[model samples]
Target: MGAVIRYTTDGSDPTESSIRYTGTVSVSAATTLKAKAFKSGWTPSQTATAAYTMSISDTILFSPASGEYHSEQDVVLSCAVPDAIIRYTADGTEPVESSSPYTKPVHISETATLKAKAFKSGWSPSQTATSAYTMSISDTILFSPASGEYYSEQNVSLSCNTVGVTIRYTTDGKTEPTINSMTYTAPIAVSETTLIKAKAFRSGWNSGTVAEGNYKLRLPDCITFSPEPGTHFSNQKVVLSCSIPGTKLYYTLDKSEPDKKSIPYTEAISVSETALIRAKAFRKGWSPSPAAIGSYEMAIPQDCIRFMPAPGTYTEAPTVEVSCECGIPDVVIRYIINDSGSEDTLYSSPILLSESATVKARAFKEGWTFSNISQGTYMLKVKEPVILPGSNTSVTQQEVQISSETPGSAIYYTTDGSEPAENASLYDKPFSVSQTSIVKAKAFKIGWETSGAVSEKYTIKAAKPVFSLESGIYTGLRTVAVSCETPGAKIHYTTDGSIPSKASPCYDSETLVSLSKTTTLSAKAFKENCEPSEETEAVYRLKITTPQISSDAGGFSCETAEIRMLCEFPDAEIFYTTDGKMPTESSSVYDEPFLATGYVTVIAVAYKPGWEPSDAAVKHIAVKGDINGDCSADMSDVIAGLQILTGTDSAPIRSDYDYSEADLNGDGRVGSAEIVYLLMAISKK
Candidate 1:
């Protein structure tokens, strides 16, 4: 028997040849078959290929041919032949006809392995293919400084592992993963809170869900100070903390970032002066936290106290108060009075006064003279009163007097008379008084009753006259004038040097008495009710035989010459001189009138010696040129002038020529025509 091959073709087959059979075939109705046989060493045999209908089973399978995908990544699986049908199941099961057919690429949701097969009618099930598709997780989450860590400004790299996957990320958690990601490089300063996420993707693959991370951005550790910024401090410290949790604290007072070796905060610290402080809190993969601000001031003790006093003056005993309040509570108060004189303490107590003497006060403490003698006062006392009365009756013009009833008893009297006492009467000499009347006086004794002063209204008189001139030898040629004065008395006087009697020449007032011979003058006065004062005399020492000249008969011009003779002393004989010599009896006397021509010297001498001589006197003369006696010279003088026509040089005009005789033309000056007329007149005479 030969085996029979039975196959059905509905355009779904593995091989390209048509279905073939051999030998006999039994077939159901509605089936069509064609057959062929193969025999060895002989011609092929043909058999009856019957047309019979038979049922064939069809299977479906689905798979991801490109398997093992990251989450939400695309995958593809194919059927065995073009006529085969494909289906898929996400539950990792064989696909049935009811499942959706794999008409396009499939996507893997998670890590998965899938089986897929092809199916055709009247064909054996295709060999099952196992495909491993894995949904990869985006395990590489880019974390800056981690969430609970403190970090300073630093760089961090972010990455992920997934084949054919493009990554997208967000730091603020506001964006999803995509091919275009808002990415950043390393060295992100963690100055604030930040969130990080990433996703993976490729073509024909869905983007993976974003993986998230939390971190806190932090700044560098910094130290701050109150009241002063940008300053350094020594032994300074600050509180160390972080913006994130579970971070270690570290600090340095220098200007360096804090490290593990830096000092950690446990308690408060004392800062002496300026210094820098830095601190940082850190954890794994996180930036360090910033430092805290710090400031401090130390307490100091006071040094010393000082005081000063204002300036002032002291006239009498004076006290000034000063105070010092400073550093310490208790202080020593030391003072010196009159440091220039003595540095001894005047008073340690509160009261310090300038005594009756000049003094300066100073304050000293702790090697310092805080208060100086910038001002002071000198004390002066009033002098005692000096009593000046020396007599009880009338005080001398400037003298005062006091009287005592008993010896050694004091007398007191006030010129003002304000009081009377025993202690007031030590009079010194040489006092002055203005009044001419008496002053009040009283006498007092300690045990005896005070005696009343004999009050007499005694008058003060003017000083007596003292004679200044005395009897003396006499000069013979000069007259003497005498004078005398008695201040309050009228004086009477005589020239005989006799004691002045009531009948002597009385001078009711000051007078000058002239005398020519030796004589005596006596002066006296009577003060009120006092004795007549003695006489005062000044002798008249007169000069004898004094010469004199006649002031009226001295000289005139020759035209009007009229000579006169008179004595200087009408009571004495006189003489004269013509040749400018002293005169004697033989000298010519002026018995006649004469004419003069030019200046001539004439001297007159008194007949007695010891008298003054007259100074040599000169007379100027001129010719009378007017020949007419009409007191004028006009045409009427020509008839009289022609009568004396002589040629004599001594001719006179009408023999009685005067200044009018020379005035021929009625003019005063003399000329030659007047002289000719005078010569003619002289010739006529």
Candidate 2:
């Protein structure tokens, strides 16, 4: 279209000095080309310009292009634009902006599909790039006889899914297998506990996961026992066991080693008394475990027998009892009395011992030995008779009584001083005795020996003599009569204070006792075949009457007063004293009336021979005009005398005039005589 054309390889406007365009401009890459048309003629037409850009393919590029791979691959995705972002999805899903952005290469280990896309800001997104990948890794290595426990040696083999794959292995659990590790050729021998690991390798395939296994091969465990090996009471149930499963246990009751022929332990075994037990364990295809020995000894407790009311003497018949300690069940207690060879009797109750005997007992059971013999010796005797109102005593008309401590026993007694025999009189009732006697008694029973003789002496004393008069003061003589209750009792008397005997005076029915003086009369009674009665006595006072005083006791107003003393007993002498002293036999004798001049106290006593003295009689005298009894005549007494004469103060004067103190003339009343005596007394003063 133009005569000549010029173009620029860069993105500049074309000029004349630019490269001239030839036929069909070819650019190795994208470029902006320009051309200018020119000729010698007038103005050239507008320059032509064109931009040349290479087209980028939307399909992704891959290195080592996707195909089958024996090993894992790292796949990369890219865009032609340097600043384009590449997002990828390896799970065969359509890629989006939210997919994982590709920064480094993506690793592929298994069969998978990878898709990718490129995006830029304000630019159209590139089409999804897709690729398919396949992986060929060695199949998991296999092991024969998977990990477990075994009792004996085992042959372990290693294999893989790929036929004839080269497999490297390691027996130690710590080291992992590599191609340089041990090579697997045949089966591996495993004796003790071990762990086996292996890995498979080929020229192009990758190695599989490390194959691992553990094998335990050893001997079976030994047998054991419950309640192992010791002495026990009663019985024991021996249980045998082994630690390993499906193992057989054998045991023997006797003290011998156990073998396959011994008793197989299926249930608990019973061991009674003293015995030993041994056990062992066994299994097939393995050596027998070590022997387990259990020595069990059984002991039985001893049963003891005892006797109640142990070996001792008893006063009366005793009941004996026999028993066993803690009382053995279903055991028989046998006993024999007095003789060892006698027939045995089963004891159910206490044994009655009426006589002396030796009791022997033993305990018997079915499976146990007889207990030791328990013997007791008992000597029995009758109790002696008791005599009522016991021995060596005196009594009057006694009735004797006898008894025995042993019931239902006959008692024999004798009145003489001899021992009682079985044929003597048997005491039936109380017997009366008026004379002294000695009682001897013994008790007798059927099977028991007679009791020892008991002697008691009873002195039957005669009744004491009694007097008709009692002992007291007497004014006249008395005749005493003595009497005795016994038939032939004799009475004796003594006037003196000595013990009365037969040599003393004998008393009759009538006897005179002198009462002129005080006397003590004693008497005693006696009889044949009886003891003498105790002495009895009577005392007679024969006291005289007390003397009488004829004068009044209060004040005497006269210058002199006449006092008289008299007694009822005509022969008694009355003695007196004027000074208020007690009158004895040596005092002044009272012959007639006496005179007292001043204040005087007359005390008198009457006495006679063989008689007790009489009590004293007293009289007091004072001056006639001394009305107040002051032992003198004065004006104060005169005024009292004048008061007694006048009737105006008669009440108070009469109270003070008791005992006729103001009766001066002894007329029993106060009058002009008392006033005249007081005036004469004042004149005399």
**Scored by CA lDDT, what does every candidate get?**
0.48, 0.75
Pairing residues by index, what is the TM-score of model 2? 0.35
Weakest 10 consecutive residues of candidate 2 by summed lDDT: 650-659
RMSD of each: 40.1, 30.8
Clashing pairs in 2: 516-610, 517-610, 556-623, 556-624, 557-623, 557-624, 557-625, 558-624
TM-score per prediction, in order, is 0.21, 0.35
Off by over 4 Å in 2: 1-303, 306-333, 340-354, 365-368, 376-395, 403-408, 413-426, 435-442, 449-464, 476-479, 484-516, 522-537, 543-607, 612-685
Residue lDDT tens for model 2, 1-685: 4456777777777666777666888665567776776655646657677766554356677765888776668987767776677899988899888899889989876678889988765456778888888776547777788888776678998888664468899988889999899999999999667899898876544456788989876445566777777755446777877777768888787768888999988898776655577777777656667667777754222445666677776667788888777344667788899885869899999998878788887877665445668788877778878988776545466788999988878999998868888889999999866678898899988767788889888887877888878988876455666777767888988876678888887776655544456878888987777888888899877777888987643443446668888897868899999887999989999989888766677899998887888888987675555565565556766666666556446432323223354566888776777777777766765
Q: What is the lDDT of residue 559 in candidate 1?
A: 33
- For model 2, how big is the CA root-mean-square deviation? 30.8
Give the distance in Å from residue 434's predicted Cα in candidate 1 to where it truly belongs. Answer: 12
lDDT of 1 by residue, 1-685 (tens): 4533334423233121446643454542245554444434545444434445433333333433444444465666654355676656666787666667667777665556556566555444455555666555545554544455444443445565555455566666677656677654444454456666667665654455667766655544443333443433123443444455556767677677668788876654456554455656666654555556443432112222232223333223345553434332333444444465554554344444433323344334442224433223333221122234433322134554443324544555555444545565444343455444444556544433345554333344433344444456543433333333434555566767678766777654344555555666666665443345545666554433344332222121223333334544544444555454666657765443444333233455443333333333332123333344444334444444444444444433444334443455655544557656656655654
Give Cα distance to truth, residue 87, candidate 2, Å: 99
